[model samples]
Target: MGCSRPGAVAIVSVFLAGALAMISLVLPYWSKMEIVTAAGEKIEVALGLWGACTSVHPPALDTLTAPVIANGSEVIAIEPESALSDSFTCGSFYDDERVRISCTSFRELANGQCKRREFRGPASLCDVATTASFLGDSTAVVPDATVSDWLSVVDNACHGIGHTAVALAVLSAISASLCGLLLFVGITCGAIESRLGRVGGYCAFATATLQLALAVLWTAEAHPIRYTEHAFATSFYLNAVSILLHAAAFVAAQRHQSLEKEALAAMDLDGGIHADGAATEDKEKAMGSSKATELVAV
Candidate 1:
């Protein structure tokens, strides 16, 4: 009877929202890598939410480890007139599907890739660290294959978010859980019925608002306009929908509470009017009996 509010529906909605939010937390939200070439060929690599497949040996779940490759080539000579630069290519190919690679080596950037000796050829890939930064913001190198149609068609996997985003996500998750608790107690707690309804409404509303705000903040920090290729992930969208549901639940609960109060007041008013009418009837009956007796005496 939370102010005669509808508690059952509110509880169900809250439960569903909480469950969805928790599920989103576990799912990989945004780990897809979009690649494009200057000639217009595009490819996408999925580095799972929790881990990535850097090389074929085994999928590394904790950290990104470079592949292992033996250094066998000698250094290329560079003259002031040659087109030589600091950049070097390990190997390039026609298509990524044409070749098989293994998580066989880790690269030493200063030591001529996987080798300590001088080496040269087409580049295996753009540096992972560099590419990681590129994913967040633009202005980073886009690795290319040597061939015109199918140049450096290199792709791999990576993971992890910035400290700020992680912090926000954790805070949001906590707030969401608390909101669910409030809803549950508000509906079932007998001692604080009327108060719990309003309290739960406010708590859920506030938490959802915070979630939306933090989502925006996370997006702003993680995928700013600086990057030409950034899109909101499944996690962001799911949270958005959950927030909407929370808002709806809050409104429903508040309205039910207001209506309940009005009904209770109306019932009290009606009862008082009925009591006064009964008393008036009793007094009229007494007066009529006395008048009849006087007439008989006269």
Candidate 2:
């Protein structure tokens, strides 16, 4: 192929790199989560796989029995009815209190102070719902309606310069720079008709595309209101896929350059033979001239 053929590879590489950059920036925003407060306020939360751990927990001992307090001071003890109802699991905890309430917010009593409640058996002390609202008129009853504010807190934390966000930023910058370099190499190879360069360009393009896709997928799967297990799994899978694509592309580019060099060497050898044949003809002509001169002189 002519040197210009590699131009296509360069073009592809650049397009891929641009895509990667766009996705890297977009994914974070897409995966953002928001918490809606009981007062109808919305708080945006940015969370990754690590943040999921804090939101999910093991269920309290009594899943069915709601905490009952007497006169704002006495904690009630329940008799062990059955192990089936008391035993808690991670999913159970997520479903019961953890999913519905913010970990930082404590349940407030009628006097607007945080209420302290005890658990019977091996129950979690953090199970009491902390979120509350003013009752209609003047009566204070713990509203059955509880709001989950974890998303808000998580969003607020993520919005700040946190470890996860900072790490992501650093990773994205590095990947972007590497991608740009690969594209430049591919372009240079195209100019020289280097087979390896074309190949490298192709590889760079492929990797950039994959990286961008992963970022997009991660952002798309994140929800502002709800937390699901599938979101976490999808995020991890996307990241893995991106990494694999990046590696594969890099290898392909390198191999392409190697092949190009071999082809170039072969061409040079063929040209050298033609030049050697011309030199041989010139030598024969000179020898013939000397013999003719000697014969005439004799």
lDDT of each: 0.49, 0.41
**C-alpha RMSD of candidate 2:** 15.7
Candidate 2 yields a Cα-based lDDT of 0.41
For all predictions, the C-alpha RMSD in Å is: 14.4, 15.7
**Tens-digit lDDT string for candidate 1 (8-94):** 667766667766666655554443345553433343433222222211111122322322223466322222211212221112211
Q: In candidate 1, how many Å is residue 267 off?
A: 1.6
lDDT of 1: 0.49
Cα TM-score of candidate 2: 0.41
Over 1-298, each residue of candidate 2 has an lDDT whose tens digit, in order, gives 3233334444444445445454534343323333333433333333442233212221245535644434466443323322112111111111222222212112232234432332332222123332112111111321222223342333433443233444454555465555656546545534455444555455555555545554544444343334422234434444554455555545545554555677889999999999999999999999999999999999
Q: Alpha carbon lDDT of residue 90, candidate 2?
A: 19
